[model samples]
Target: MPPMADIIAPQAAAALLAELVRCPSVTPLAGPAGQGPYGEGRYAALLGDRLAALGASVEFREVEPGRPNLIARFDGPAGSPSVMFEAHSDTVAVDGMTVDPFAAEVRDGRLYGRGACDTKAAMAAMLLAVQSVLAADGGLRATVYVVSTCGEEITGLGAKALVGDGFFAGGRVDAAIVGEPTDLDIIHASKGSGRFHIETRGKAAHSSAPADGVNAIYQMAHIVAAIERDVAAALAAMADPVLGSPTVSVGTIRGGSQVNIVPDACTIDVDTRLIPGQTFQTMAALIHGVLDRSRAARGDLQYVIHNRPAYPAFFIDGDAPLPVLVARACREVLGRSTLRAAPWASNAGIFAEAGVPSVLVGPGSIAQAHTCDEFVEIDQVVQAAKLYAAIIRAYGGAGAPATGARGE
Candidate 1:
């Protein structure tokens, strides 16, 4: 293979990133043309076309119609382990942005756009890095898969579908790199997330008729307070060294429509971030217990708990081959090694749950993701491409690297 330096050059990475930022691939929201959120189908198609032009086998997998995922494979030597580089194609909706979300404008050294920092930049870097490596002898001991997934902004449905399809069946992947903006930090673990909708029911009655009916809003208030107290305590006590601690937030609440009438129903949407060693089932049971205790105290109220698995927490051991290689690559290409953990959820968890060890490493910062005027440093794009090339060289060989510490 040619030297890694020649494979992922600065100019090539910057050009790829610029091309990606030019695509207006914002997540779709409810509204009119150009006024509403941008669609990702066009961007996926563009990426697929580029991959095909680069001689990689490209497949467009549609999770939902018009919202497609692109998978491109660069075949390597026979009997080599497969490595997947994954990133989301979708960006959060740009509802209240000051700048043109699709301009891909480069000011100073940063590229600004909706998806520039969130993930498209990382996708571009990975693609250019893979293409560069393949351009060289192309006779490596591993196949590289570039996957651009949809619905990462909404429950990671694209990743779930890919995992459910057994895409990694037959022990194909030895390791995976999920390109989430981490400021070039290597994330070995990330918190899992679960969404819960709690509904309380009661009988409506006239406001003046004191004891005529039960007030669901009033009942829900008590329940919400109890949950806040209990959940806060639980999260604070359940702390992990790497992930820090679990977190709970009462994100949304809806109750009475009219002020005079006693409301009969109330709904509370809760978002909980779980650290490693915590499962959705376990968390759900804890929530149920909390509700049960509250209900027991108030026999007049009725409530229901609906639990949804947003994403599971993932942890790769500190000594894991993927993390080690990623750290080494960052040191070689960026003059520093990265070792950190993500506080939020990402698609890396999906790969880990599928038994494919994965790590998160990419350009940009998480702070810039899902925000107005989102941008990524042009230099970070180049550095990420070089790091990708280094990882490919390090892990695309016989005998995979060793596993590291599994963050508790």
Candidate 2:
């Protein structure tokens, strides 16, 4: 094995990204069999093969029957902690992109494709970095695990399943690094988010006889107005120094069966973003309290929260060892210090909540994520690979055991 600094190169990262982008692993939607642009099973298999070729022990963890996750581990010396590098394999739908989402085209220093920037680039860079680390005699003191997961754009089912399966059992891992498009920044915190459905009930009657029945639509309208006011006030009163404040918005609403009849039922879908220290139960209680107070004022209106959790938010302290290691690695390899907070949500929150000290680090810009012309700069890809190698070298050095290493 060669030294870590001499084993990685820019071209290697580009090649990996190109191969991944060509797979067209878009988010799955209900559609004809094998007709959607997502479902990254093929790509996962390809990556598994690559990991095996690099001497890593690979396992295909199936979260769903058709959707699989790839977990590959490179063994190091004994007694060191294991570090896990995590990334989502599935991408958001390329519904309105102007470019061919699967082309993997490179134009003007940017690689244009569906998952190129959102995350595939990070996966590629991480893989290449692992290869470089192996080439170097730096031998890991702890094992390094690379996980490509499913359902990041939707329910985070892959991550949830991994947690439920005891993947983090025995406390082998000291840290985790979630490869999101952070432009090489280290994200120590992220806002939590959840979706809710509010339903109001009332008696229906002919529109011509207003006094004969209750109007559920009117009841819902009042509740919606109250939510807007109450939620806005809550946000205004509390703001985090890093993740800002919690927010709520009504995303959808439906009511009424006919124009001439008074509607007896109405539903509103709300999206809520929570800062650290908040939870679904607490938010639900607050919303219910608002509704209860409003109903008391109205005398005849009632509502209930129906939506379940879409996802949860997580936040780690900025000064945690994981962030410290990641920032130091970035500065040493990329010549720049990294930021420590992300405004949006990602799977890192899940890992953090599960007791894994995880930091978000990767190539590309978040602005390009889920956008039409999604792309990652070639330079960022190369730099990320080098940074990953440096992290491995710093933690796993030659003859170091794989027992207590963190994956930040």
Candidate 3:
């Protein structure tokens, strides 16, 4: 490996981030890949080479056929604590972007492009952290795994599969840090999300003879009303003090083949944000209860609800050793102590479900993510690299591990 000062510098990290932005690695369809843009193989290969150059063992852990999570491992001495740093590789589509999505333009100390803020910056920081450790004695007292996951903008398929595959040789990873757009603050908790569809069915008939057929649209209207009136109240009452209230919104509605016919089916897609105490089953029951009440009011209605996968909410004790180390690093770099909860879902939730203590801390603002003109401060990106490097040094650097090593 080259000297850490050469490979892990802020300019080097920024260059890596710029190259990642140029990849246009948008979410691929979740199946067998065609000659299309679904494969993250290109990005994974690029990262693999860099990890290998730094004397790390790199592997492409395939979640799907073409979407592989890049797992780069730098081994430390046996019995030393290990830490995993996670970042996602996929970005949302660039259908309506104001700037060229793949241009990777840098202006006034901000990098503008897709994935610049939502996460590729964090990827660069984690990579530099690993390189910095290797530059100092070729390894740390504790091992480190830098994983770049795929399909985070979609379903978090890579993270789910990575955790299922048994992280860090199926052994304990003392702590994990997920790089998300948290403005460089430590995120102790984030809300989860659930999506599902509800459908109502009825007989189709000529609109001219309105009384001849029951209206599924009318039934759906009653159902929607019930959900808005009752289920919402239930969610509001079940709020968590830290994360605030759980909430639901009906995003889309579709029905009726044509205006002349009475619709046989009406369907609505719903999105719900959950707090720690709320489970998918619990939320499902609440919706079902409301539906039943609507059904009883109109005996001629038939309805079906299908739930998509759910992301459970997660929280870590703020005073835990991992958070303390991360907070100290942030303070050292930024000269301020900042901590908060995120309203969006992150892989941290997935790791927490697996019994690994995880927190989210990274370079940009969540506000700029997925926007038409997305961008991240170049200074933040560089600072994030330094902060990550410091964290690795504080916990896994030189002769003996720190007092907070292994969350002691």
Choose the strongest candidate by TM-score: 1
- lDDT, candidate 2, equals 0.80
Model 3, 348-375: lDDT tens digits are 8887777777889998999999999998
Candidate 2: regions farther than 4 A off: 1-7, 32-34, 397-408
Model 2, position 296: C-alpha lDDT score: 91
- Across 1-408, the per-residue lDDT of candidate 2 in tens digits comes to 655554455556667788999987776775421465658688888889988988889999887766888899888777766788889999888888988898888887789899999899888888888887677654565689999888888778788888889998878666788898998988877788888898988889999996898899999999999989986687668787777888988999999999999999999998888887777776777777888899899898877778577556777766666666777888898788866777688888787777788778999999999998889998898888888877877666443223322222
- Over 1-408, each residue of candidate 1 has an lDDT whose tens digit, in order, gives 446565466656666777887776666665422334566788888899888887889998887767877889888778776788999988887778776787777888888888889998889888778777776745545788889988888878889989887787877777889998999989888899998998988888888983787888888898788778987787789888887888888888898878888888999999989888998887888888887888788777688888988999989887777777778778898899868777788998888887888899999999998888889988898888878877887777555663333433
TM-score per model over all chains: 0.93, 0.92, 0.92
Q: Which stretches of candidate 3 lie over 4 Å from their true place?
A: 1-8, 29-37, 168-171, 397-408
Better of 1 and 2 by TM-score: 1
| Candidate 1 TM-score, C-alpha based | 0.93
Q: What C-alpha lDDT, on a 0 to 100 scale, does residue 82 get in candidate 1?
A: 78
RMSD of each: 2.5, 3.0, 3.1
Superposed by TM-score, candidate 3 places the C-alpha of residue 109 at a distance from the truth, in angstroms, of: 1.5
Candidate 1, clashing residue pairs?
317-404, 317-405, 318-404, 318-405, 319-403, 319-404, 319-405, 320-403, 320-404
From the highest lDDT down, the ranking of the candidates is 1, 3, 2
lDDT of 1 at 305: 83
- Candidates 1 and 2, the one with greater lDDT: 1
